[model samples]
Target: MRTAKRPLQSQASEAQKQAALRYILDAWEEALHDGIEPEMLANAALFAALADLIDLYGEDAVAKMTTGLSRRIHHGEFTLRRTAQ
Candidate 1:
């Protein structure tokens, strides 16, 4: 028998999300210390992320989802540091 699959967002709790980010950040810092360039790490990370997303959600759906990223980015949703203007 086939089991039903849960939606991606419903699969992880908010705390799980934070923990996941922490783990990724730790690995990122470790890679930096091991002499990997940030740009190279970023490119690999993006490629890995997009490839996994496409595998799970398909290229069209992933493309549609990422279309809003431009607006979100412009709004500084991903900004971690800000300087006084």
Candidate 2:
């Protein structure tokens, strides 16, 4: 009997995603070690980092900061990306 294949998003169990994310993140870390400032990181990594930070700092502080940030965004107090920079 032929078995079905899973989509890449859910394929290779956990190892594939972990390996790709680890490779990308290690490049960022190596850049920092080499005194280079990365202009951007993947959104997935950012979300993970935020979750890790919240775990480290607890909910209250991170929540307060995000709430304030949202308030600033609502008030037009922060810069946003443009269509063309």
Candidate 3:
């Protein structure tokens, strides 16, 4: 019998999201330790590091990270969010 796959958002919670964000930050720190370029860090390098973390940590972790990013966006913590007038 086959089981249905749960969507990432459905599987993630606030705490899990925070943990994933922490993991991403840690990965960024590690990349800095290896002397990755700043511009690269802002682009593909950051994503690469995040992908490595997700590979090591699992899909759930990535989903949580996505959730955390979304929360930040919703709260206007991310630059893309619009400020209240």
Candidate 4:
């Protein structure tokens, strides 16, 4: 029996990783709204590590992740980094 190979583009790309990071941050925001202390920084770090494993966008992915993170932080969600300190 022969197995089919997956297409290269079908694999997780930098955009996909960035989208995932956005999703994670969104969830974190929701959690914050609900008074849950979600580990936003930890999750972001993990996502970054995972992003490094893929062969897609490196800096671009990080930039998107930062943007999403900043937006959430500005909106009063759980902060990954202290802004006023």
Candidate 5:
């Protein structure tokens, strides 16, 4: 029996994604140890990370992803309410 091989582009894309995640985690660990604030990190990191994503994925694909992201955010949004103990 033989296993089917993944398409080259799929394999390459997965490899690139893994590499990018590793790179992000490494940089984040250093920044946190250096006491970078979470709010500050989110502000700067979002732009940098999205720019890198747009560079890799192209504007149209990223734009589509953003629409999906907005949907997820909407679903994840919560309301605060007072509860009786």
Candidate 6:
């Protein structure tokens, strides 16, 4: 029974994550339509994300997690556009 429950729980967790992302993206789009500059929005988004993560997981843990972000960014993990090299 425990093993069976794990799949259901994982699916629910994934669904929740998707829903949360949609909500955040919708709010971000609305903010942009309301005249918020993209750079300002990006800064505020990073601050909010880091602050909430630190609050939930502590400063040291969040700092460690963020240390990999530079490598991820360089690898284009967050890139929306790709062109032929």
User: Which 10 successive residues of model 3 have the least lDDT summed?
Assistant: 1-10
Could you tell me which residue pairs clash in candidate 1? none
Worst 10 residues of 5 by lDDT: 1-10
The TM-score between candidate 3 and the true structure equals 0.44
Question: Which lDDT tens digits does candidate 4 get at residues 1-85?
Answer: 2122222234668899789879977976777898775576567656766565333444544454556776787787765576675
Tens-digit lDDT track of model 1 for 2-84:
22232334467899989988988999999999999999999999999988877776676677778999999999998867989
Give each model a TM-score: 0.82, 0.34, 0.44, 0.36, 0.54, 0.75
Clash pairs (backbone) in predicted model 6: none
Q: Can you write out model 5's per-residue Cα lDDT over 7-52, one digit (the tens) per residue?
A: 2123357789789778877887799999998688878988986776
Off by over 4 Å in 3: 1-10, 45-76, 79-85
Q: Which candidate is the best by TM-score?
A: 1
lDDT score at residue 63, model 3, on the 0-100 scale: 57
Which segments of model 5 are wrong by more than 4 Å?
A: 1-11, 54-61, 72-85
* Residue 50 C-alpha lDDT in model 1: 84
Give the Cα error of residue 51 in candidate 6, in Å. 0.6
Q: Give the alpha carbon lDDT tens digit for every residue of 1-85 in model 3.
A: 2222333344578899889878877987899899997588788855776676566556666656666776786676756335687
Q: Comparing 3 and 6 by lDDT, which wins?
A: 6
Candidate 1 has a TM-score of: 0.82
lDDT of each: 0.80, 0.60, 0.67, 0.61, 0.66, 0.74
lDDT of candidate 1 at residue 24, scale 0 to 100: 85
Q: What is the lDDT of residue 10 in candidate 3?
A: 44
Question: Model 1: how far is 64 from its true place, Å?
Answer: 0.2
Q: Whole-model lDDT for model 4 versus the true structure? A: 0.61
Error of 5 at 64 (Å): 2.6
Q: List where candidate 4 sits over 4 angstroms from the true fold.
A: 1-11, 38-85
Residue 30 in candidate 3 has what lDDT? 92
Q: Which of the two, 1 or 2, has more TM-score?
A: 1
